[model samples]
Target: MVLLSLVASHSDIDLETVAKISADASQVASVVLASASPVAGAITLATCNRYEIYCEVPQSEDVPAARSEVITQIAASTGLSEETISTALISKTETDVIEHLFSVGAGLDSAVIGEREIAGQVRRALNEAQASGTATGSLVRLFQAASRTAKDVGSRTTLGSRGLSVVSVALELATDLSNDADWSTKDIVIFGTGAYAGATMALLRERGAHNVSVYSASGRADAFVASRGGTALDESTLEAALSHADIIIGCSGSDHRLMSSDITSLDRAERPLVAIDLALTHDFDPELGALAGVDLITLESVRMAAPEEQAQSLREARSIVLDAAETFATEQRERAADAAIVALRRHTQQVLESEVEKVRAQHGCTAAAEEVEFAMRRMMRQLLHVPTVRARELAAQGRAGEYIEALETLYGLAVDAPVAPSMKNAAGCPVTGTQSAAAHHDAPMQSPALRQVG
Candidate 1:
């Protein structure tokens, strides 16, 4: 199956639009799979600043239709107009999809570059897809490769040396905004009990923040705090926690936004309160930033404030991602010739079996007959090995069509060649011709951009 990715991220759109689309990410895969589209499988990766759907379709030609189907499903699920959704997303197929996902998993595309949290998010996305039975083998391999690429980048480069992340940057901004720069002196309250919340908690502890309270709208706070070392707040105690909190971090992205009025109504201390909203769909309303005695830190603000990594480190990381993408694409291309190779081997095996059966019939399974059969089998293997190797070589060079044609012409072996996903340039021209691999390797990598769908 061909890989297609529909991406809406902080680079191409505002965070508000990203949040709106991400709100229904959990359901997008199921909706797409249940539809009449040619999509064989799908995996959704929804984060604070990005929402991506990776799909597996039957053929390269089905990509446009599959893209349309996914966009329609996303629009339907997210209550967005098709045109709006299409405008927000960039369509990626073949190697572009591979490179994009690798870059993302390695945090090259994050608002806070080189953040490690996205790697875990990428792994979890595949796991979630597998659990839902919506991830096909091709998509699974793609994601696994992404994970490996992420690890390679992390280990080989100093890109993440500071352990930077959205949460870490927000906390850094919070430290700057707080009256006391020391995290231990600040009374912190974290909203939501998911992965982001857990990450925030760990970072806070690293910064020596001990006076922390956890609150979850879905009653998960108790269990979350039990394992994570925080005081759990129920609905009745939430307002009091808010009032007492000197620093409030939101990771929940819950439907119930903490409005300015919610905090204003509370008899909060007149001291400075640094409110960090790390959620994509904000847990705190934007108006909260305007409140007296409060300073807001958001994903957008964090993006602006995030420190740039060393230029050499960034280049090293990107090179790793590019190399990984090329290797993955080459392997996938080689796999495209598998059907042809299998057909050739099957044809050879049939001939060998027929000749061996004649030997057995003529010699009544004698030792001489066995010797003849063994020699014939060895000769057949020796003959097939070169063609098998050539098939893979031809496929990787984007000449699988030629290999399949040769098989058909020589042996009357009408093998159904597997369709490899075709690469396209930003202008929508196919790049999978015989020179595609060489051209792609020589060309500089470009950022994924909007490819508007009709």
Candidate 2:
């Protein structure tokens, strides 16, 4: 199957549009798989600033239909118009799909370059797709390679060594806006207990901020704070906590927004409060930013404020991603020759069996006949070796169809369609080895060809 990717990210669309698409992204994969005729499988990756769908289609010609179907499904799920959805997404195919996903997984495409959180987000997207049974073998391989590439980028370069992320960038903005420019003395209140919330808490601590309070509308604050070294706030105490806070960071991603009135009604705090909204689905109202004595920082602000990664480090990381994408593309091309290889092997086996049966009938299963059978089998394997190697070579060069046609013309053989491998490594990586024993059993032997008389 061919790969197709539809991407809507901060680069092409506004963050508000991204957040709107991301709101229902969790269900898009299942919806597309159930309704899209040309889509064999799908995986959705929705982060704060991006919403992307990776699809597997039956053939390259089916791409437009698959893209339309995916957009229709996304519109149906997100209440967006087909025109708007179509306008927002950029479609990527072939090697571009591989390169895009690898760049995304490596955090090269993040608003905060070299952000460590995106790698985990990419991994979780694949896991979610697999759990929903919407992931195909090709997609599994694609994502696994992405994860490996991310790891390589992380290990080989200094891009991600400073622990930079969306949360950290927001905090940096908050520190700058603070009167003291010090985190250790600020009374920080963080909303939500999700991954971003946890990240916020850790970064706050790293800056020596001790008086941290966590509030979760879902009542998870107590457990969240217990392990993370923060005090939990219940509904009755939330207003009191807000009154004392010097900075507020929102990452809850809950629908229950904290309106401007909520902040205005709090008890007196003469000092300025920097409110950082990190959630895609904002926790604080936009009007809160306009309120007196409150300075608001949002994801957009963080995006604009994010520092550029070191040049040499970024170059090194990008090189890693490029190498990984090329390797993945080569492996995919080699797999395309599997059907022709299998067909040729089966044809040779049939001829050998027919000749061996004739020898058995004449020699009555004697050692001489056995030796003759061995010699013939070895000779056939030897004759098939070069053609088998050539099939793979042509496939890698995107010419597998020529090899298949040659097989049909020379031997009257029809190659069976290759099936996606069902086997996975224990670590969930796709098994890229020769798919079956029959295709690889005689791979090692070599010899000269003898004319076949029918």
Best by lDDT: 1
Mind giving the per-residue lDDT tens digits that candidate 2 earns over 210-293? 999999999999999889998999899898989988998899878879899988887756667889999888999999889998
Measured against the true structure, the TM-scores of the candidates, in listed sequence, are 0.91, 0.90
lDDT of 2: 0.84
Regions more than 4 Å wrong, model 2 = 419-454
lDDT of 1 at 305: 96
RMSD of 2: 6.0
lDDT per prediction? 0.85, 0.84
Candidate 1 worst ten-residue window by lDDT: 445-454
Clashes of each: 0, 1
Residue pairs clashing in model 1 are none
